[model samples]
Structure formats: structure tokens, C-alpha cells
Target: MISSPERGGTVSTPTLRQILRDQLAPADPRILCGHDRLDVPVRWVHSSEIYEIGPLLTGGELLLTTGLGLRGLDGGTRKHYVHDLAERGVAAVAFEVGRTFDEVPDEMVRAGSAARLPIIELRSVVPFIDVCRAVNTSIAAREVDELRMRALLDDALHDDLAAGAGVAPMLGHLADLLDAPVVLVTAAGALVSAHGVDDDSAAWRVVDRAVAEVPVRSRGRSLARLVVGERAGAPTVPYAEALLRAAAGPVSVGLTRAGVRGSALAARLVEDLVDGRPLRRADLETRLAGAGVTVGGPSVLVPLAAEAPDPRMADAAVAAAAFDSMARSIVDATVYALVSVPVGGPGDVDPVERVASGLARSTGLGRTTIVVGDPVGIDRSRPGADASRTLTDSLRRCARQLGLAASAVSPAGAGRRVHTAREMLVDEAIGTLEPSVRAELSALAAPLAAHDERASTELVRTLAVHLAHGCSATRSAEVLHIGRQSLYQRLERIRVVLGFDPTEPSVYASMMVALRSLAAGA
Candidate 1:
């Protein structure tokens, strides 16, 4: 996997022949070698009279010297100089003749010829600075042109992807453009998408022998890499490294699109899974496994509900990436995540809580409530239909929790939080009571509601808020955007109408049940 020297090697720049022909040099230099081989790119023009300049150059430079180092040097030293410059990939050596020798040194020319290095003899005095200025300006112009070309290419690739062309097709197109087999592998070396490589093994072999590898990254995360040079006989791709680097943006966009599509499909499957009508066990197992949801295991489903335009998953594409391989779907404002929990695995923490926290942090979702249901273990030995019935019941529980999560989640300010349905068991129990019992409980808040309706007061809201804050007047005031005195005034009104103080610990449980029961019906 010998990577190319520079990632930006595809840029078109001024070459030695172009520099000489563009009248960038003065006093017509004599070519000591055949001028046909002058295509070496001149990255910069450096005027170094030191003989030890070989170690100083990073390569791809056109060296301009006045024969200062060649003075009193033998043939062996001169030959060493020629070979060093060639090894450094110096475009060409232009030696100014007047300062050190009357005629160009014969041994220098012969040594350059042996090394297949281009040598230019400036017979008349030449101003190294003037030549450098002209050459470097052209170099800058060519660089600008190359950058413009890369931008145009990237834009075209992005447009094609946005039009629904997938990553594989784009990679194939890139392989054609670069004239090499290309591959993209994950950080774990799994093949993500590729083109021109024969098969999976061949693709990995291409990775093993990568001639150029460009990292594909987005949103400050590295997702994968592009590997070129698939086979020994493949024509060398022009600017292979530069083209791969340019393609990184479009690659990330393509991968994001793919992830979002998978999430969207998973969401559809989840909707079906949660529906009242059960899918056959075979059909359910196939879909669940495809989405990375383990079948025949203890399953815990967590439903995350938020208001429309949830800040956490604003970009469904990013949400898809953040969830990794989890089976999650964004249905309306709620995200349903189906998790497979190992028996007695890890600590008491649920996987959904850990994942939801990360998802919230990554999406900048200020608040999220994930109501987790009891884990249901599917008996694989049972009939397929029976097993699917068990899962369907669990999913139904999941569906109900989504609604409960909305009504049950308490007012918690701005950070990652996870709440389970068990925490709201009393509320759930009250809501499920027989209609007659439910009616009696709902009556508890009727007085406050009636006062609110008649006077346009927020007595009912204040009661709920106060109860949600554990009967703390100070915290309720802060949440209600009121002063302590104003909150106390509302509390007094609530106490007068309801015939009991909501702050009494003896009646707190009854008050909570009444409020939650009313909210559940609402």
C-alpha cells in the first residue's frame, strides 16, 4: 500500500518545456539533453547556488544555479550532484555560465546524460530572479486552473448523486475518469462501495496494494477511504490521488443519502411491526434481521417522542448515521428504536438509554424522552405465528408508550434524559381503569379546569406544573415564568377550588393520578 507522495498530485502545473518555451527565461539556454523529455512538472523555481541543495529540496523544483558549487569539483563530485538532483525529481538544471567557467563543464553534461536528467546551459548572463518571477506566476495560474477543474468535477458528481445516482455508479464513473480500478473501504477495512475492482476479494487486494488512498470525511468524522490501483496492468490514472481527494465530498453525500434511505425503510417496517395486525413470524424475522434487530432474543423497544420539527433529528440523514446499525425509524415526531438485549448483559442500564443520549448529543436535540417497555423474550421453539404474536404484542406496547411518553415525560430542562414507562406506572394504571373509575379520577381536576375556562386563568396548568415539579413552589414558578408570589396566588386559587392543598404529601399521589389520567384522555 505505497501511497502516492502527495494527495494533491493531480493539479496541472507548468512543466520544464513549457517554462522554457513561454519566454520565462532570458538568453536562450542550450539543452544538454534531448529536449523531448522536458515534461517534468516544476512546482516552484528555487535559486540555490549551494552544492548541498539536494537535501534542502522537497522535490518538483526547477533549480537555477550560477555554477557556484561546481567550482574546483571533480567528475565524481559532479556525477553525485547530477544523480542527487534526479533523485529529488528536479524538473531541470539551468546553470548560469559566466560566473564560474568560461565554457560549460563537460563532465556535468555527461553525468546528467547518464542519469537521464535534463541540463540547460545559460551561455550568457541570466538574472535568476527575473526568470523565477515569470515562471512562478505561470505556476500560480496553472494551479488556479487545476483547482477550478477540481471544483467543477466535484459539483458534477454531487449533482448526479442528488439526482438519485448511487455511490457505486459514481465510483464507476470516477474509475473511468481516472482510468483505474477504485475502491472505498471503511476504517475497519470493510468494503463500503467500489468500482473497477473485479470482486470483493479483488477489491480488498486493491486495498492491500493501494497506489493512492484518500480519506472520505464529513461533519468532522472520517467515514471511509478511496483506494486506487486495482491491478498491475491497469493504465495509470491521471491525477489519481487528486481526483480521489476531490471525490471525498460527493462520497460522503452519497453515503449519507444511503443511510437515510435505510432508516426510512426501517421506519416503514417498524410501523408495520407496531400495527395491531401481526405479521407472520417468518416475514417478521426476515425484516427485523435485515435491520440488525436480533430475533429469538429478549427485545426491548424504546419510543422517543418529541414535538414536530424536533431539533434532535432535524436532518434525518445525520440521524441515520448517528444511530449506527440500530433498528430505528423516525415516524412523525417519534423515533422508535428496536433493541435486542442480551440476558443479564452489562449493568442495569438499557442500551436504548445509552444510544438515545449519544443521539441527542450528536443531533443537538435539547430534550428527548424514551419510554422503555418490559423486555419480552421470544420463544423460538414455539410456532412461528405464536412467536410473531409475542413480538407484535411487544411492539403494541411500544406504540402505546410513544403516546405515554408524550403525556408521561415530566418537564426536565435541556439535556440528555431517559425515562421508562415503569416510572409512570401509576399514571398508566389510572388511565387504563374502567370508564367509571376513570370518570371519578378525572373529576378531581374538573374544578380547576372550570375556573381556568370561566376566568381565562391557568389554574389547571399551574396545578399540573406544580405537581410535575414535586410540589415545589420555587421550581414551579421558574418553569411557569412567574414570581413566587404569583405562583402562590395560583396555588391558593387551586386549593380553594379543589378543597385540598396540592402540596400535601398525603394527597400528592392522588393528585398525580388525577392529573395524569386527565392528560392521558386528552
Candidate 2:
């Protein structure tokens, strides 16, 4: 049986019994069969005499018809006709018998009974239009009631936002209004907030049975999902869907605001350690303590580059990787996390390895490169900031290496692996050239850059590829997806622009370094 809400809340549509007793009482309506389904909500009223009208209906309509269409049909056909209407989810079939038949057909009655579809007969004089008007009026009234409830819910959410009470109170208010539990979970399935339920309780099972789910998105990428429990009765799916749709925007904004606040604080901690500012050990310890990070311990600076098509998704993946770490920050496309772990103890895995393992298992970032700095003591003697800077530089170099490997024809060595800062120091030095040297290098590529700006040519990129592949024209052509002749022509163009042969070993080496430096933002 369907149960409806009280008057103050959204009202459900009028049921067949309610329509018969309240609206069609003057017509002396009586149930001919299927008395058990009187509570089925009548979505609308449709008047038709078409024998095969099932396909025309969108379901949940009370069908009103005279017996004229059944006059020539056999009993089996008549039964099939009623069965078709029932299968189409007609709330009830009201038949007026006097014009076409002396009494209700037993075949239709038997079919309605078998299908448990409500069948009614209008015995008194009543116009079909009158019944349609009454049902439509009732449906409109229910819609108005739902609109009022929705308005009230929207107001409550806005008030909560203005009052600075956060999303929990708004979710609680929604839970009370709908009389169902609500849960907000991150894209990683981490619980952000819940109302009227405990995660461990049986009531939370209702979340698993959510009738509506709305995505909470930020920067055009989904960050979380809001799940609303189904109401016990009264055709609540539509109401639930509407409520979640309205709430999703505010919820996403709230989550983003919270993240920004947290990220700002984390960024401060990271900046203090990597910005080359002199930070006394005592002052650093005090700030770390305030940020809930323990200092004077073995800490590994882990730099990670995760691949994501969208920047927001990359941020989210990095955030997930930083969970439970001492401190973390997103600098450009890379994420750095300072993780603390036991040093050199039995069964003590490398801190960077441990964190990378966790990130690999949790984040679905397709190709990632992790650079681990040597473990350092965060004390007065050791320069923690300098070490962090070195780790960051190493991460940048590894990222460039990974990018180059991806663009190569032979990418057999592009698999993800952890590298130490020492292993990448030479590339880091070359990429992080002094400002005066970088200016000179940029001048060398000025002609190609100007050409790219004017004609959108690939001269600079072609030169970079040729140099990166050991000046092998064939390999560069294969990587660039161009013929060797086209590659030679581009090389000739570069030679004219630079006033030198690019394939010469001395010139190739210098130009390659300059291009690599430019690519690394030197």
C-alpha cells in the first residue's frame, strides 16, 4: 500500500480510491474488481476507446472508456485488451456500460483481477470530462504543494550558508524535512558528511539503496556524490531526485570552500620549507606544531607528478595522495608531500616508497613519477628548506624525462618508478640554468619562436625532437609522424633561421640544452 505525507509536507498524487470516494462520489462509482490496488497513485486521467492504446500512454494514468470498442471482440480478445491496459500501468479503468453493453464484461473483469489492476464502473450519469477535470485539479494541487516544500528547503539551505554553520546543519535540516538519511561522499568514497544516520548503523544501508544521487562538481569535474535515502512510501523517487538536484550546487561550493581554506594553510607550511626563506629551527617547529606536523624527526620529502586530463582532477588526485601525510602542497602540476616514518629500523620501508605505494593503490592516475629526497633531520644543523628545494628540482627533471619518454617512438622504458634526487641532479642543474644563461638560450630560439607565433610552424618542436633523439633524422621523423624528407626540410628551415647547421654535434648539443631549459621553465 502507498503511504502519503502529511499536509505540511509534499503531498502525493490522489489514489484511485480517493478519486472514487471524493471526486466521483456523485457518479456512484463502485469497484468492479482489483479492490486491493485502490492506493495506486493516479498520475493523470486519459479518456480513450482505442483497443490498443497501451503504447500511447506514458504510464500511471487512469483510463476512462465506454464498452463500445469491446462490442466486436471475442472474450479472449477482451481479456487481452484489459491485460494490455494493466501492463501499461493504468491506475484504474473506469468503464461506462449503458451505451454499448448492458453490464460489465466478465472477460475484462477476470483479466483485471488476474493482473491486480483496479477496475471501476460508473453506474450513475457522469461525464468523462468531469472526472478528468477533478483528477487534473488534484494533480496540480499536489504539484503546488511539492513546489512549496522545495522552496522552503532551498531557503533553509541558503540560511545555513549565510549563518556559517556549514553543510552538516543543512544536511540535517534536509534529513528532517524528507524523513530520510543523507550522505555525502568524496569521489574517493571518503565520507565528508552525513545526517540522520551512522555509517555503522543499519539505517546507513539506506544510503546503499539511495533512490537519488547527485554529483557535486568543481571546475567541471565531479568531486563528490550526494546520496539521498528513499522514503518509505508515497512515490518518493521524484521528490528525492528533485531535492538532491537542488542541493548538489550548494554542497559542491561548500566542499570547495573548505578545501581552499585547508589548502591555503598547507601551502603556507610547504612554502616556508621550499621558498629559500631563512627559517629558524624553533620558529619552524612552532609553525609545524600549529599545523599538526611533528618536527625533529626523520621525514622524507616526496615529489610526485600525476597525470590527469583536467587540472581539477589532478588536484583531487594529489589531495588523495597527501592524506595522512605531515604536510603537502600542489605546485603547478606536481604534488609534494612530507611524510614521516621510522628510519633504518627493522621492517621500516622507505618513507617515500611507502607513500608512493599508498598513492599508487589509491589514486587511479595512469602514469606517475615519484622522486624521493634523502631522509633528513628537521633540526638546527640540517637545512630542511634546501633539501626540499633539491627534491622539488629533481621532481621537475623527472617530469621532463617522463614527458620526453612519452613522446618518443620507443617508450619501452616509460614505466613508472621511484628515483632519488641524486640520480636526477645533473638534469636538474641543466634545466635550472642561471637567469643570464637562460636569457641567452631563449635568444637562440627567438627566430623559431617568432616563426611559430607568425605561421604556427613546428620548427622549435621539430628541433627539440631531433636533438632529443641524438640527431637521428629517421628516429625524429618516426616520432613526429612525418616523412624523413619532411624532417630534412624542417631541419633546413631551422638551419636558415639559426644561421647554422642544426645537425652539427656542437650546435645540436647547445640547442638541445637551451630547448630543454625552456621546456623546464628556466
Candidate 3:
């Protein structure tokens, strides 16, 4: 048996050339087999002990011997030996001629080859150690070449990151490097930008929406996502999604660098503007444009300020790594930072308020209220004046809704915007209100909801749904597949218990919202 550090164990089935290479010069050509370069590492053995350790040997280990090892063996016995060795994961068999049975054994060769094991006979004298050394040297050189390539890649990345480059230039550069197109998206799945020209909106939307949410806190920021384009004719969407997600890291950083330069400068300037306290949008735009980001689009500017749950970078690093792996697996974008903070500035309703409230409820942060400003659209091409004003106005509004210290953005907002706290919660609240009322009504309706002896409860539900959909008796009758008079009678019974006329528009709206909210809460 030979011990291999790579396998972390002793291998019983050995390769002849590898054993020779380990103990001798690894530069000799005598190790060549079938006119092909012998590249596999292995150890040699001439003893019958090969059978005992065969099962433990992973394939690719060469075996060496002469006829003396199997002298006097019958055809059946020899075939069995060769078969057993092959079954044990032996890579090849080498027979040294001129020792104990000179001519090649047809049975052994046939059996070994049938097992896909390369069996060779030495035609002339050759030093085994020279063969081993040759293979070892070649392998060492190959490893060195691989290491050099890896080093070159690392060096390039280090240089790109050193100067605070953005994700766009980096994406464009990578696309150039890979000869492919790249795109960056917001977590909510909006396309931030793309490198190439093939516009498959469907594919883009699918990938963008499927990406993981980057946990972040950006005031009034929409969620951002990252997407990578697949090569033409790619058959699998899932695999393609994963590939793009894996590529998002570098792409995200690239776009961020390209987009934030102006924003960062503008941010500093804004601090100054607010300090003296007379803000001119144009001045801010000029400063922002100088930093290279256009502030004119219908983009909302969201200031990110959230204290991390764990102050140590260690937790952040772990989350980043997890997010990276998840991005690779799910083609989703993610962020590693706190996404909540105190509201500042004019009475601005911090959008993150909703997310915080939900998270707080889910995580026990406490009762929270949030306010949000309407979305401000930014034209991508003219990304200066309009964007800056929109952002400023939105921030001011956000400050008002969320209490002074209760407002904040997600940490991930450094890159992009997601839904604000109010939008998310209002939507949540709207969804659950009505369903809950109906369920409470369900107990009242249990005798009624379940009382179908005359199908009165079902008729009532149908009447309600129809009235909820449209108060027309004709429409309700058509929908319920019943006569108009039967619907009227059901409505009367519903009114008796539910205590509201379905025809009253105001009453209907309240009932609808209540039912919808109740359902949503469920």
C-alpha cells in the first residue's frame, strides 16, 4: 500500500509510474504509454497484496508487475485476478517482459482491457523511477501554471477595487472580458442598466423578479436587482438564473462605483446645503453630475442610515458570504447591512417604515407607524435636476410620517430603493381586513355559511360576492347561476344577520375592505 496525501489515506491499488516518479527523476520519457503523455499520479506494486487494498484505491493508480506475480495461473484464474484488480479501481497494468513468462498473456490483457483498464507490456528495459519522476515533474509544472493564472485574476480585481470603481464600468469591462452582455437590476426587479443589446424583456423580468431581495435600508428607495444575460440558445432557465446571480457580486459593485461617485459628492454637498439650510436643486444637481451620476431621471434619492444589529463586521461578513452563496444558487440580489434608523429632515414619511414595522412585528421591535411619499420617476438619460428634486421632496415627506427617531432606510439602500414602510404595510393591512371580518362572520355564518339545507348560506355568499363585484341583480343572478328572486331572498336573509344592505355603496366598500383585510391577515 502507498500513502497519498491528496486522498488522506493509504492506497492499495497503486500506479507504477507514480511510485517510480515519487522515488526518482520525474523527467524521463520512458514513462510514456500508448504514445500518450502519462499524466496520472500513482504508485507501483509487484506483490499479490494488490487484492487486499484494491477496494480502497480510487481509480487512476497504475499497477506494475511481471509474469512472476501470476506464474502458472490458468486462463480462468488469470482472468479473475485481472477482473478483481480492475474492479478494485486500478487504472492500468504494466508487465515487464523478459521476466517469468515472456510472451503477453492474452487472457489477462483481454480481461483488463474489457474492464477499460490500459494494460501495457514493456518491449525493452526501462527504469521505473525515471518514469515516475517524469510524470511528477509534468504535474508540478501544470500546477504552477494554474497558480499563475489565478494570481493574475486576483491582481486585476485588486486594482479595479483600489480606486473605488463602480459596478457599471466593471460590468462593461467584464462583458468585454467575457465577450458577453451584462445587466444590473434593482431588488424589486427593475433594470438599472445593461451592457449588451439583446433585449429579451420577458427573460429580463423573470430573472429580475426571481432574484433574492437585498436586505437594505434606503429611505424611499425602490428595491434593486442584478441580472446577467444568458448566451443564446440556453435551454435551462434555473441554471441560467443561478449563473447570473453568481455574477451579480462583481456587476453590482461595478455599477455602484459608476453610479455613486456623483451621488457621494452630492451627498456631502447636501449636508453643507442643509447646514446653511437654503437648498437649490440645481446646485445639488451640478455637484452630483460632477461626481458622474445623473440626477435627472424619475429616480428617488433615499438616504441610508441604519445601525447594524451586530456592530462587528464579522456578522456582516458572514451575511455577505451567505448572500453571495445564495445569489449564486438563486440568481437573487441581497445586501448585508442595517435598514432602519431615526427619521430626519422635514416631515418625511420614511418608506423603510413599512419594512421596519413588518420586521419589527415579525421580530418583536414594537408597535411602529410609517409614512411614505409618492414615487418620483426619474428619466435615466437626464439623471440630474429632476432626480435630485424628487429625492429631496420625497425625503422631506418621509420625515413627517415616521416620528423623528422612528424613521430609517435599509442598509442595502446604498445601492438601490425598495418599497417604503407605509406602502408595504398599507398593502398588508388592506389584504387582511375583510377576510378576518368574514371569518368572524363565518362563525355567525357557520349555522348560516354551513346551513345549505336550502342552500341559503351559499346563496348569501354568492349574493355578497356578486354585490361586491357589481350591485346588479342581473349580474349577480348570472354569476350565481340562480334566478333574480332567489338572490333577493338570500340578500334579505343576509341583511337580517349581517345587519347591512348590500346595495349601499358606502356599506359595500367597508365590507369589501374588511373582508379583504381579514383574508390578508390570514
Candidate 4:
């Protein structure tokens, strides 16, 4: 399921005939072979060499071939050859009428049609290169559109995170750009999000059918499907699929940042519809409710951090490698980690926190400090912005209280450490204790809370770690990324303030207790 990023999603390109039809006119473009009228986009043309083409064409191409070089060309030879192509799932067979095969033989056509294979017979002498160019040009144009759409989507989606414009409005923005209606459907083919479609429209039906066709699959369960709507007879552009796939990563990213923006927006719109407002909510509810989730309810917000800080690493490569290793490990475990820059750094605009939160619930982490706030009530919908603000404030306060540089919020059950740490931090005395030691020994170490600042905490913790490592000053210096002289100065500062040498064996026992006490208090 997880391929290289480049090959992650299939790029559907317009077929040769389809390209010609789109470029020329939507006239009576006859189907000689395959589903002629079907809008099969040409991903790319395959080489004439049989071995070379086999891998490139994956069950969908309007193969335009003139039986030029078949190893054997006897009675049933060509017929069997065409049959093989049909079995390979080529969308259509476009045989040039004037070539060696001349007109497509009735037997070949009959055999192909019997296999439900689309066949096209080129009446006029169109160059094979012309067909290739047509398809290529169409693909290039569509690629340009796709790229433009992705860029515009990223720009529009930024607001969803920053301004808290729930899922509906965000999807609406996408629909507007594509000039098509949008329907956010649930797994059982229910329409939860409807933008640009009104009641008594055939567009809704198309959306419903499409949703049934493309079931949602995320985190080992199918929860919802996204269906794009167009007019009654409008072509079912794979453009929508392209839009969905391309938009998914960033949308997921934004949703993580904003926390339940999609579900919250849907809830608000549902309430509006249920209350006899202008929107049509019941129809949407009927569609989405079948997905096995209540149309209205409370949901907790959670965030997953891709990597934790390793004080041992000094270089960027090591830090990045750590994050990548953690991300790969976690994503495989049904969790998606969003990497972020460490807090308190200048201009660290990492999207890790937001992305983690958006993909939080899917990760199935119970709850912790990483996941802040409460399960927002959805029985009667309110603006998502309010809930988001509450969550942000809660997280900010927790971070300040805990002195944590970075963290991720998961559901309460999964992120219990965060909850415990936050609970510990709320104690007034614990907040002033040496950061790590006090946090760990919050209750017992309250009496030894000599200096409250971070510098004091670091000095004590550094001295403790060094002493614990068999008093190897060199190893301690390496871990702290400081010189021996600096380490000594830090130890001296600790001795002066705390009245005990960290290096002394007799003082070690007392220091351990003090550190543990400070941690419990925190």
C-alpha cells in the first residue's frame, strides 16, 4: 500500500482517441474497439517492444497497434494475438484500417467484443506518431492543471489550519476551483459534505454512486469516501480522483493542525440542516450515517509527534535520521508521526504538531498531554474555531507548565504520560522546582527546591547523569556537548547552590533522592 512517493498514486492520462475528441470536437466519435466513449486517460504510451511494454501498461490503455511483427501470422494466429491483448485488460484496441491488417476483421472484432473489450477501427490514415503526440500533449496539459490545482489547493488549505474553516468549506474551496460540485461521502456511500449541489439534483445521485464505487480505506478501516459531483450527463472526470489523492496529504496535514475541522464542520452543517435551515442535512445524514459513526457526537482531539528530542545528538543529520527512523516505525504501527522543529528555535515553522493532531484519532492513541482539551460535544454544532482555540490554549499552558520543548497529543488512553506530567506540573511548587528532577520527584523533592530556574535544573541533571556514568567526566562532557572545563564549572555551581559535590559517592545517594523528589513534585 505504501509505495515510493512518486508512484504512490496512479496518474490517469487521456487516451489517444479521447484526446483527439477533446481537442477536435465532442462529435460522434465512434468506438472501434474497447469502451470508445470512456474517458480513459493515457498514463503513458508503451514501446513497441513486447517485453518493454508489458510492465508499463497496467490493465488500462487504448492500445493502438497494427499487427506489424507477430512471430507467426497464420489462420487463427492474429485472432489469438488480439485475444491475448484483450485478456491483458487493455481498455480499447485501435487497429489502423489501412495497415497490414487493413480493416479490423469481423472475427477479431467479434472476439474482442465477446470478451467485453473495446475496439476502435481507424477509418482515416492517422499517423501512429500523431496519436502518440495527441495523447502526450493531453497528458502534459492535464499535468499542468494538476500541478496548478495542487499549488492552489495548498494555498487555500492553509486557511483551514490557520483560520479554522472546517472540512466543508475547505472541500467547497476545492470544488469551486475545479468548477464541479463536491460531496464528502462516508464509507457506506452516505453524503456527509455537500457543496455546490441543492436538493432535487441528479448530481447528488452521481455522487452517491461514485462513493459506493470508491470506498474509503484509511488505518485498516473504511470510514468515508470523497465523491466529486458534476452535471447529470457530464463526463465522470478522473480529475476528481486525482484531486482527492493529491489533496489528501496536505488536507490530512491541515486537518491534523486544526483538529477535527472536517468532522466539526460537518456537524455544524448537519445542525443547520436539521433545524430547517437552507442547507439539506437529512439527505447528507442518511448517506454518512451508514458509515457506522453517529452523525452527531463528541470527538476528542489528539496529536502525534513523529520524533522526540535526543539530547545525545549534536548534528542535523543525526537529528533528522532519528526523526525519520521514528516516523517509519510509528507509521507502520497504525500511527502517523508529523515531524516538527524543536520549540524555542527561531522561525521553526514545522507543520509537525498540526499534522499530528489532524491524523490523531486515526492513530488510536488513548490520551495524554500530547492530546489536549476534551471531547467536544457535537450534538449541537458550534464553530470549530472555538474548540480549536480551547485546545491550543490548553496545549500552550501544558507546555509552559511542563517545560517540554516538544510533544504530541494522542487520545487520553494512549497519551497517559502527558496527562500525568501535566497533572504534576499544575502544582505551584513543582513548577519552580528543577525541571527534570523536580518533575520526576515532585512530591518528595519540594524541600530541596533550592534554585527554580532551568539553568539550575540543567546543572543538577547534567551532574547527576555524569555521576551516574561512573564519574567519567569525558563521557559526561561528550553527552552534554561541552568542554571538561565547562562541565567542572557547572558542577561547581551545583555544589555552591545545593551544598553537595555531585561527584562524591556519599552525596550520590542523597542527590538521587533529591532528584527523585523534585520529579515527583513536578
Which predicted model would earn the best lDDT? Answer: 2
Number of clashes found in candidate 4: 57
Model 2 segments beyond 4 Å from truth?
1-10, 25-36, 76-80, 113-116, 151-166, 172-241, 248-342, 345-522
- Which candidate number has the best TM-score? 2
lDDT of 4 by residue, 316-406 (tens): 2112323311111111101111122233356643333433333343333322223122222222354333433332344334333322312
TM-score of each: 0.37, 0.43, 0.29, 0.39
Of 2 and 3, the candidate ranking higher by lDDT:
2
Tell me each candidate's RMSD, in Å, in order: 23.0, 19.9, 18.8, 23.8
Clashes of each: 0, 0, 95, 57
Ranking by TM-score: 2, 4, 1, 3
Q: What tens-digit string does per-residue lDDT give for candidate 1 at 83-178?
A: 899888777888877788776678778878877788888777767788889878867865665565566567668777778665676676567655
Clashing residue pairs in candidate 2 are none
TM-score of 1: 0.37
Candidate 3, superposed: residue stretches over 4 Å from native: 1-165, 176-181, 186-188, 197-229, 234-424, 428-504, 507-522
Candidate 4 deviation (Cα RMSD): 23.8
Per-residue lDDT of 359 in model 4 = 33
Poorest stretch of ten by lDDT in candidate 3: 323-332
Cα misplacement distance, residue 406 of candidate 1 (Å): 41
The local distance difference test score of each candidate is: 0.65, 0.65, 0.43, 0.46
Question: What is the per-residue lDDT of model 2 for residues 62-147, given as tens digits with 9 covering 90 to 100?
Answer: 88888777888899999998888888888889887778876789888989999998888888767889889978987888787667
